[model samples]
Target: MNQELDSAAGSLPHDNFRCGTVALAGRPNVGKSTLLNALIGFRLSITSPRPQTTRHRILGINTSEAGQIMYVDTPGLHRGAKRAMNRSLNRAARSAISDVDLVVQVIEAGRWTDEDEALYAALVEQSSPRLLVINKVDLNKDKTVMLPFVAELVAKHSYDEIHYVSALKGQGLQELEQAILQRLPVRPPVFGEDEVTDRSERFLAAEMVREQLMLRLDQELPYATTVEIEQFNDRPDGIAEIHAIIWVERAGQKAIVIGNGGAQLKAIGTGARRHMERMFERKVFLKLWVKVREGWVDDENMLKKFGYTD
Candidate 1:
């Protein structure tokens, strides 16, 4: 894995500078990944419209003159997780918030569901300072309507601070950042100034391919699929050579992923390769294969092998 910091290492952390880890906790489809990317000023975590798209605890680092904030983007804490993989996701999400310096509960503006309430209950048990981030505020044209909802919410719940912002449009983030920095303890930076994340290119490669699967596959098919990077080698020719396998539970699912005349597979490879080149900052030669791993999602050992467990 390449851990080299970029040339522009930015300003060093000065006296009284605050630094700590912050966990973006929320229910599924609440735009936590988008908020993480926006806060870091880098596309470190993959995003899709699907729920539970983030299955791992990904750390994104943002270093500035003020301080270095290590943001942990976690999987959504959802209910009714019957499968082993789903259970693992909840464990990862819960584990991430336990050790973080601050917990930011992100939810869509003007709406709060049962899942949101469930996650809030979990956050109450944590010792970290909690903040409420109302994301997707841009979607609500009638801003006045939110006052009653927020009022009712504050009446029943408690938060150190509440902020409204649209993660997609990058709105009202400066205030949120300042509030977060103020809450963190004054300490030196833990990561290099130029580092955006601790994740390696190898892990990111699998995620890029899985993002494509979540976007292109229909219905429940995406949930049954996972990506494995069989090989990720930076060739002497200056091109990243990647070999990946798309694991499905059934042969029928494998046929669908491969598609007629291999067109679907081709499209997945093309899309994932383009993202890899941009994120890796190099040309990529990607090759993909679809394989059937019967009942991998429910098998605990298989889930661990696929990097689903913490």
Candidate 2:
């Protein structure tokens, strides 16, 4: 086995091919997931209007002749350390940014919050090359202010480049891709040419369920919820069976998710199944059950069991 691996490694040739990991780091709701989906041409990371929607480091691979840019979409780094769950998310975000080829610091157009400033300040101290990106540019009414805003950003720390893009509208992504490709080191592609993400379908299924909860619930309930896939079976036929448990921190939360007579759970399940069917291009039977895991977020064992820790 050692001889065979050595032979394959010796024959490798990537003199000028560009390939490396790019970490998308930013504050909450800065559109990191949207930008990642736009660049990869697929929906790997779940997105919602809610802040801190992402809780893991999702890897999206963009393969092209220009080069392969493996983008790591991380959860937004925030100061919410009220619970062990929030600290787990923050640790995931920090770990994703380290040891990457480049860092894409996403920020909203014409807006800079305290969290953004704190994240940017930390990025400046890192050795990796960082690119300041102004996302949601199309939402800004005054286009002329972008230049000044970007200039002001440059004065803080010399970014490799500044990109203005609307991730939802698919504007200026080409330029961002070009900049990423230029900054990447010469190496062979890390993922297949046609591969979009490194995450499995089961993980995506769980995220989709959580997305549904975020979309349907209000206030702090969504944050108290997490999904666990208990059973996943691929039939010989063309259908997939999935059974998931929605973990809530309280019994009241479980009632909220279950609704008066399982109506809310059925609605969430229906939406999730439809979305999975469309994404997978096959039949998906999704089943969701709400359970009270009381104070799971603060328990390290429970957090690790649910795949929330690094």
Candidate 3:
């Protein structure tokens, strides 16, 4: 691995440089967001066990002495009856594949199914330069058993390379990162050397809240919930004030988010605030409010207003 890194390092130009985008594409809940966070060394994208937690194309920038890699984390693709929001999310995910220099197709280590094949087919049809990334390897009891199958699949699909990584455990990620950097097109860095992600602090705050909601809520409630940051204020004392609204599709869903006498909401707030403080490395005062936005998923105006539209 050191030799490989040395070879890649030698291949790169000597001057400060930036590379193009690398898109993370896969089915829902396959650890795409987690992998992006690992690659960038920060949580630029929100992650949960719930499918489709990532609804937008989030860019995570990694700057090093070698170059910069802008990782685009998109919503997971799924087959279903089309709703306005679903269509938008799918479109955003698919669109990332076309323009990016490299596409990282994340697949669950033990959960390969027909849907993954279909996604692979669609991805292949685009003729994009791609890599097969088998995620969640840490959860596998027999990693060697899956490698041959992954190798065959990669051969069949004609992918540029294959990487097995445990995103959550940070296993085998350095290889993945080196491979990504090697494959990226050489150019000047698109963002500042200090910038990690393109998303605004408000956007990340909202996503952190939504991630907590998804983790805490049960059943369909998690799927029906969305978070929006209404206001953010930075104080002089190294603290920030954040006000956000958690919108649910129905009144019952709203009640669940608020919890029995607001216990649940408090729990969500506490979890989200802690994460915010850790990410920002400062104090965060998060104000969360529950609102019922009926049919927000289907309502075009509501979806557009919340930055969910295409």
Candidate 4:
């Protein structure tokens, strides 16, 4: 049977077969979204240094002459004090690990913590085929510094394989792609050839605005903010009109978002409009309004309305 399996793998037409799913799991700020965007050759997911930036499971698909590889970008796993939002995010992250053809556990090459070890242990206990992906290799001046640590972890955990790559710089991605494709089960393409992501345009637009706000705002401002796309329309003149609402937790928060003489809101709108125009490939007229929605994040109904829950 071993010989037959090897022979079948060798004879398989790599170009004709469709690949399978590879889930990207990690702790917050470990660059999972960056890796996804880099692999798919586009910015499908909004990335920020802020933790819990990705609240949902985002699918990024890569198609080649060989086959298609679907990568799932999950929310970062974090230890919280049993808050509803925290619990939901952790559940979303773990959900990606189960029932997937391959699991790619992304870890920061520069840091090794007990938290990483705990998560690694859980993944191992599941007996799933997995790879330890060491992201952010570009930051390491001496790449060999991580080699010994990676080897120790692999030996201790008995991982199926270890892959080292700088996801931000696109290093070692081809090899990683080959490793993923080699493990994927035989299947047909799950989506069309032209589709790069599973998220809708409205979702992307809202995320883009949220990402900009997160980048621009400091203190508690980013945490208290939520963005919703109220209207999106494309005209025959190749222009897209977008209206979005930025919700804050308090009236004071609303004032901060609007800024002195509306400076901050205008800045966020300008930045978001440039990105939206580039993404939609048309002129974007974005209208943003601020409203105070008290306790929106913790409110279950509000969370469901925002698609954080179904």
Top candidate on lDDT is 1
What tens digits encode model 1's per-residue C-alpha lDDT throughout 1-310?
2234422432474698889999999999999999999999988889999999999999999888888899999999999999889899999999999999999999999999999999899989999999999999999999999999999999999999999999999998999999999999998777777788878899999999999999999999999999999999989999999999999999999999999999999999999999999999999999999999999999999988888877
Give the residue spans of candidate 4 off by over 4 A.
1-16, 125-127
**How would you encode candidate 2's per-residue C-alpha lDDT over 1-310 as one tens digit per residue?**
2555445433445667798999999999999999999999998889999999999999998877667789999989998588999999988988888789999999999988888888887787788999989899899997788778777777876788888899999999999999988888998766666678878899999999999999999999999999999998998897999999999999989999999789999989999998899888899988788899889989999999999866
Best by TM-score: 1
lDDT of 1: 0.92
State how far residue 255 of model 1 sits from its true place (Å). Answer: 0.9
In order, the Cα lDDT scores of the candidates are: 0.92, 0.89, 0.84, 0.83
Which portions of model 2 miss their true places by more than 4 Å?
1-15
Candidate 1 vs candidate 4, lDDT winner:
1
Q: In candidate 3, what are the lDDT values of residues 29-122, reduced to their tens digit? A: 9999999999989877888878888998898988787888989998888888378889888888778887888888999886677768877877
Q: Pairing residues by index, what is the TM-score of model 2?
A: 0.94
Candidate achieving higher lDDT, 1 or 2: 1
Clashes of each: 0, 0, 2, 0
Give candidate 3 misplaced runs (Cα > 4 Å): 1-18, 236-238
